[model samples]
Target: MNQSHTYDDVPYPDLCYAYTHPGRIAAIATLLGMQPTPVENCRVLELGCAGGGNLIPMAYGLPNSTFTGIDNSARQIEMAQQKATALGLDNITLQTMDIMEVAPDFGEFDYIIVHGIYAWVPPAVQDQLLAICQQNLAPQGVAYISYNTLPGWHMVLMVREMMQYHTRKVTDPRQRADLARTLINDLVQMIPESENSAYAAFLHTYADMRFDKLGGHTDWEDSALLHDELSEYNTPLYFHQFIEHAAQHGLQYLAEADFTQVMMHDLPENTQLRLQEMAHDTIELEQYLDFVRHQTFRRTLLCHESVDVDRTLRAERIRHLYISSRAVLLADNDGNEYFRTHDGSTFPAEHPLTTAALRYLSQISPRAVRFEPLLKQACARLNLAQPTPEDAHMLAINLLQAFTYSLQMAEMMTCSPDFTIEISERPLASPLARLQVQIAPLISNLRHEQVELDGLSRAVTPFLDGQHTLPMLVDELADMVAAGQLAPSKEHATPEQIRKQLDHDIRYALRWLSRAALLIG
Candidate 1:
């Protein structure tokens, strides 16, 4: 029943995002007071690195840093290798290997990443995965592992069981997925709404989520359902259970990859105090919080147990890091003073210095600024004389706390990747993004963001060298359109209409690329 081949047949779109990058991972580790190896020259390993989508961008951004990716699927590995070769990226190596077979001789890495793999493998394999992290990770290394958490998985598991049972006789992966999806669709219609049964509520909630993911798209949904829901093994564990497993392998929890989850400050004071009483240690506290938050997924970072972890966050740590934020200032009549993030999370901007700092950070966003200069600039903007030592200290603490609790408000990183938001003359695009355009139109930007390109945009991408002027780039698009290779939005339009649309698209694409930080110049 060649189950593993299903993944190769319908490959996962393994794109990189900001949360998974080693730079972001190491920065979080640094904030927690673990002196991780600098991301610039770090050695990284990713298990189940499907198609190397996530690791490739990191290699491209940090040319000096080396990366190795291991996947069990030969086709996915081959695809990744070909893409790496095309980009002239000498820093990364991709291989076909199973997690159970990873050896100590693979050498140590400053950062190890295992995502979308741990909770889906068999128990023995899960143990081996942790062992590999413990043995192959550098003494001060941080490893990022994401898993299906308990309480949240409790609901998902029930739905998954129903899915598997409904399609038990189906052999074809796609058919099975289609049948399971159909089953869920039918159940949603047939099930009675009961306020008492958690199961009924789960079905309603899950149906909405399924529809949201499908987005009326069948092809992509079938593949996702096939791999994620119908995979042969999908085990989940409580937070404490996972911690215990890592402890057995001499690994300790450092922090979550997403910093906001760890910030207990956001919880109501009564809830916080009650939870504190219920939890005797960090592990217990996190497990209880999962119960409270109904957490279904987690991206946890771990380090070797021998290293001392300082859970207490000090404002002084902010000075050692570079900061970036996507927060924007909003108008308020009451002058309550706050900034709102893309996700609607708000941070109080009542403090004069922090508000000035946030405003400045938002202006240069998608680009990181050093902390001291950011603070200095904010102080200058406030029209204040040089901050007294105590004033500076308070500002640092306030800024750090605000950024930590409100992730959308600001982001701090140990280092920044080399890319710019400014559009350049000649306008060079990211070599990695250009390479990705060959595989799929949805490519990762320099900031580890995904941007989807239309036919015109993709056609213009390959020739986005600094040598090509805007006129030349437009001419290339015009050629592509004329040859029937690139299709505009409106089909059967007159040539004049096509030309007008192409001109608009060319300008929009370049500006989009520049804004996404895909412009290298």
Candidate 2:
């Protein structure tokens, strides 16, 4: 059977910022008490992995883990193959295949990821997806599926429906998107400020949300609009509806990708009590909470029904994981009881030991520390006596819970990336990042964070083979500028002037790369 591939036109090749990493997925599964397959040497599969933007980073980071990505778009698969080849990664395979055509003979995988595909595909394909999850998942494997959820999506659906109607006759994705945007903006402009209709309110709210994304830069978001809003199919389900769908295939909800998303205490007291009273099971409780929060999207994890998922929060899990934090200490009248992050999330340090521990973690941020050593150091800093076995256990549990609850303040990981904080002489760049520069300026960092390199930075990254110093880099740039391969900031500049500018530019690019965590050393 032939399937129409829409992604070949407007490729959905964006990186899912970090949470999809097998390391993070396996860690969450471990916390739930399911003995998940180790990420180091696991068999991983990704469905609808357009151009390998998300899965390639995991493949690069975990070189021993074998990866297979299947996308319907041949163009996307070709791009992914080129990137893998350029990086000299032998552990990954990219194939252009439809999800419905996936066979059991393809073999089982430890981690199966289906992001941005569940709700957008046809209903028959959705069933086939779950069947694949049931048939191909290892005994203790995990499946991550992200989808558009309902209630909150009610408004989004209205907008998407309008966009689809407006672009009904347009075949070209880009032109359809442009027409839809113009129509929507025109409708909004026609509405008077004095008009207090629900339609007017919805238009303004949606407009604000769209334009405000990408830091109020609308140029890059048009593709997203084309793909999501004007795509052929988009069907969002209620939380319980999705759970029911999973149960049909012998898969049960393990937990959310982010622990804090499932935390009901974050809601208002009255709302929480009301939701608890109305719900009989965890799934129902989550569904009701989604209604309260108006959740439009969810990244949910699933495991076989036979696997026991421990819903209880266990502190013992923290001891085996590595910890890192970007939270910084703030001065206070009562001796710095608060730790804050760049995103403005604040964690109040109520306990003496917890307070001291976070300060230490903040100082050594982006570098992970084990629980035992971190605890010992924090206790020593506080001039506290050695904790009893019980006390030590309790402290570890509390810290882990706090970190999970406040992820913006701290992070815990099941695996660590091979990266360095020190900028060595003639520093070497991340080999994966250097390869990515050949394909696109947007590259994945060692931390799996997507970073967009500027023109100068992009040009310099390929030459950062740990063999070039500042002078050598300038010489190469001078030649390129003289040959017109590289554009000068000021046209008609002399080679000497260009060399001088290249010196400053190369240094700036290296510093930026270091800050972006793309430098290996």
Per-model TM-score on C-alpha atoms = 0.92, 0.90
Tens digits of per-residue lDDT for model 2 on 259-320?
67888646788888888899998998899889889999999999999998998878888787
CA lDDT scores, all candidates in order: 0.82, 0.81
Per-model clash counts, in order, read 0, 0
- Candidate 1 lDDT score relative to the true structure: 0.82
TM accuracy, model 2: 0.90
Top model number, lDDT? 1
**Candidate 1 displacement at residue 333 in angstroms:** 3.0
**Which ranges of candidate 2 are over 4 A from the true structure?**
1-5, 194-201, 211-220, 332-336, 379-387, 454-456, 471-512
Which residue pairs show backbone clashes in model 1? none
